[model samples]
Target: WVINIVRFYKVYCDVEPKRQALSKANADLAVAQDKLVNIKAKIAHLNENLVKLTAKFETATSDKLKCQQAAEATASTISLANRLVGGLVSENVRWAEAVRDFKQQKSALCGDVLLITAFVSYLGYFTKKYRQDL
Candidate 1:
C-alpha cells in the first residue's frame, strides 16, 4: 500500500507541472487570439473609412468652392487612411510574432503532456509488475 501511495504521489507530481504549463499555454493562446481579433477589427474600420472617403471624392463638383472643400476633405481622409494603414502593418507584424510564439509554446506544452502520459503509463506498468512479483 505504501508503495502504491508513493507511486501515485510521483505520478501526481509529474502531472502537476504539465498542468501548469498547459494552463499558461492556454492563456497565451487566448491573449494572441484577442490581439488578432482587435487588429482585424481595426483593419476593417480603416477599409470602411477609405470607402466613405472615396465616395465623397467621386461626388465632388469642379467649382472652386466645392473643389477646395472636397480637396481638403480628400487630403485629410487620405492622410488619416495612410496612417491607419501604417498602423495596421505594424499591428499585423506584432500579431504574427505573437502567433508564432504562442504556437511554439503550445507545441512544447503538448510534447510535455505526451511525455508525461507515457511516463505515467510506464510507471503504472512497473507498479503492477512489482505487485505481481511480490
Candidate 2:
C-alpha cells in the first residue's frame, strides 16, 4: 500500500505540469481569436472606404469628359465668329472705296454737263462741217 501511494504521488506531480501548460495554451488561443475578430472588422471598414472612393473617381471622370466637350464646342464657335468678322472687314474696305469713287465722279459731273449744253447751243448756228471741226 505504501508503494502504491508513492507511485500515485509521482503521477500527480507529472500531471500538474501538463495542466499548467494546457492553461497557457488556452490563454494564447483566446488572444489570437480576439485579434482575428479585430482584423476582420478593419478589413470590412477598408472595403467600404474603397467602394466610396471608386464612386467618386467615376463621377470625376464623367465630369471631366463633359467639360472637355464643352470646351471644344466653345472653341469651334469662336473660330466661326472670327471667320465671319474677317469677311465683314473685307466688305467694309470695298464699300469705302466705292463711296470715295462715287464722290469724285459727282464733283466732275457738273462741269461736264455745262460744256455739253454750251456746245449744243453754239453748234446750232454753224454749218455741219464747222460744227464737226469745233
Candidate 3:
C-alpha cells in the first residue's frame, strides 16, 4: 500500500507539471489568437482605406484629363482669335488705303468744278454785254 501510494504521488507530480504547462500554452494560444484578430481587423481597415484612396485617385485622374482637354481647347481658341485679329488688321489697312484714294479723287474733282463754274459765268456776262450794244 505504501508503494502504491508512492507511485500515485509520482504520477500526480508529473501530471501537475503537465497540466500547468498545458494551461500556460493555452494562455499563449489565446494571446496569439487575439493578436491575429487585431491584425485581421487592421488589415480590413487598411483595405477600406485603400478602396477610398483608389477612388479618389481615379477621380483626380478624371479631373486632370478634363482640365487638360479644356486647356487644349482654350489654347486653340486663342490661336483662332489671334488669326482673326491679324485678318482684321489687314482688312483695316485696305479700307484706309481706299479711303485715302477716294479723298484724293474728291479734291481733284472739286478743282475741276470750280474752273467750270467761272467759265460759265464769263460766257453769260459776254452775252449780256453784246445784247446791250446791239
Candidate that would win on TM-score: 3
Task: After superposing candidate 2 on the true structure, give the runs of residues whose Cα lies further than 4 Å from its correct spot.
Answer: 1-11, 95-134
Write down the worst ten-residue block by lDDT for model 3: 125-134
TM-scores of the candidates in the order shown: 0.39, 0.59, 0.66
Best by lDDT: 2
Cα RMSD, each candidate: 54.9, 9.1, 9.9
lDDT of 2: 0.94
Q: Tens digit of lDDT per residue, candidate 1, span 1-134? A: 99999999999999999999999999999999999999999999999999998778766644557889999999999999999999899899999999999988996898899998987776775767684674
In candidate 3, position 19 carries an lDDT of: 96
Question: Residue 113: error of model 2 in Å?
Answer: 19
List of clashing residue pairs for candidate 1: none
Worst 10 residues of 2 by lDDT: 125-134
Q: What does candidate 1 score on TM?
A: 0.39
Evaluated at residue 33, the lDDT of candidate 2 is: 90
